[model samples]
Target: MATAAATIPKDLSRLEAQAAGVLSPEALAYILAGAGDAGTTRANAAAFRRWKIKPRKGRRPRKVDLSTTILGTRMPAPVLFAPVGVQTLAHPEGDLATARAAAELGLTYLHSTQAAYKMEDVAAANGDGSRWYQLYWPTDDELTKSFLRRAKAAGYTHLVITLDTTLLGWRPRDLDRGYSPFLENKGIANYTSDPVFQRKLVAPANVAPLPAGIIFSGVFQNPGLSWDQLPLIRSSWDGPILLKGIQSPLDAKLAVEHKIDGIIVSNHGGRQVDGAIASLDALRPIVKAVGNELPVLFDSGIRTGRDVFKALALGADAVLVGRPYLYGLALGGQAGTHTVMQRLVDELETEVRKAGRRSHRSLSRSSLIRTP
Candidate 1:
């Protein structure tokens, strides 16, 4: 009889393969797809290998401090669940299971605008856990305000507005299967449940999938969105605002100039842009631009503890992990999600201790050397 550990592979890649075996071909493709030829998606992982961690020769610290606070949220570790939508495809519980796991672990859970479950229900599932709301700004101002109001009332204390996905990317995998969960009303729980959105529906019968999906599609993206609209968000939600999807130092500088609370240096996990710069390669320059003016969070291509370590050394205050945990959720639901996160946190502690350091805070560019 083999133990669970003996049966399940610890390698993240193998874990993803296991998940692929469990998920439907359509679901797997949607979860795995990157824009166009996936050039940037591939680059995100490659950028991590371009640097080598430099271990200092000295007495190793017996304990490492992984705790950090971002935008007033106290976390046990500097990790947050990246807002992945349509989670029901991986598991029936979807965001509900992930929310519970985040609560148990005391890590921040970022609820997606396109979440499979309603925000209020997900919040309830999260219990007293710290949660941040990720908004995919809609075309309607009232609907946007409604989402902000609801999230705040539901106990979400921070606002993360994704800036890159003003328009959906040309995802070949999703397109190939003609499978967009949103079109099927799979990820529109937030919209369907919203009072503002409901009022826009011509009739109660129109609230069903086909009609509601059309309404959702109409307001989902605002490609004409501009910097001038930031004030609307500021007015609608009274919380720390973090602008995600920024990869350019100029944009980071602009975020500072706009008085935004923080910036997440990302490229939407390479789902938005095909040949965009790897988010890791973009981190240092953006951090250089922002300085200590605002917190700089990182995402995209973060797959391992060493990846988190590298991001911190390059100047990210924290990192948002996406694919790895979702694969865990696919494997064993909530327990698997918790296990994957714990492993990452534990590995991060190991990395800090082995490098002869005691805290992630002590890591800096000096801890790594750029490789050829």
Candidate 2:
């Protein structure tokens, strides 16, 4: 007897609609909305439609291996959860649920510096799961080093330093609602719980709302941070440090010269700049510029498995998925996120089979054909 595959929604639109049913209206806007007119956000997915995969039928590999050890870590698939903060806005469990889900699936869970749950708590929930920490680079030197030290101690294998979002883009939606998650002191778990941040406090953080400047430093960015300052992290951390939010081929080349271990060619998921270059379009140039000096991961506008395929074909070593799993978290918590990732991995497997490739790594620019 032929067994049926577990039915999950293949269409992301359908899954998103389901997520919306359970999520607050404010959260829906925050997760889905982008900067300014949001041209870049929409374009991120639409740009995938521009490239077509040239498949080889009736030539499937004897066995398909979606598992990748390429990142020098044990990731069952190349797809990883992009570091998104304020996950509590989607569900009560927040980063813990997402982390647990990723751990169960043997996927890497890269959590945000501004996550609602403390790093220690999220790590506890993950329970031997592969995990990574992301940094937003606060202005204070000791605070930054404090973060790096804590993550290293907490069993995180990789350090993903976000390069964009130094000042935060002019996000019209968040501004219109006058909702600054940081100002509300939401998503500052990693900061507020840290000794360095606590020592500098004039009074208890809960006594009164912090000034905007403190919130930015204690939870988020330092636009003044520069290339000369990057070595601080390299010197402090022991594991591979990946710079996320790289876009330019020139900057990608510079990243290599700077001795960055890896670069994620992203534009903050089109949230930082309106009319930013679609990350997919920028991937080729950056890959060409740096070649194989370091791993080039891709993010921004990865909604489907075919989208994942396009990124791999275009030269992305792996792809980061953000909003989709967030949507899943909004809809079903840990189970929801697990289901969403499983579907995407299943879809990627189907893509690999259809392309007649043994694994995602074998895919290259030659596997694609540009259509007029």
Q: Please, what is the TM-score per model?
A: 0.97, 0.94
Total clashes in model 2, counting residue pairs 3 or more apart in sequence or in different chains: 0
Q: Per-residue lDDT for 358 in model 1? A: 80
* Residues 1-372, model 2: lDDT tens digits: 011112235686476677777778778878877889899988787788889989686877777888876458878889989999999989999999999999889888997998999899999989899998999998888989999889988998899989888888888888888777777777887887899888876766677446633655544667787899977887899888889999998888888888888999998788998988788889999999886799999999888888899999999888899999888787777888888888888888888888988898889998888774
What is candidate 2's TM-score against the reference?
0.94
User: Model 1 TM-score?
Assistant: 0.97
Candidate 1, residue 62: Cα displacement in angstroms equals 0.8
lDDT of residue 48 for candidate 1: 95
Off by over 4 Å in 1: 1-8, 203-207
Q: Which residue ranges in model 2 land beyond 4 Å of their true spot?
A: 1-8, 209-219
Write the residue-wise lDDT of candidate 1 on 140-193 in tens digits: 999999999999999999999999999999999888887888878889999988
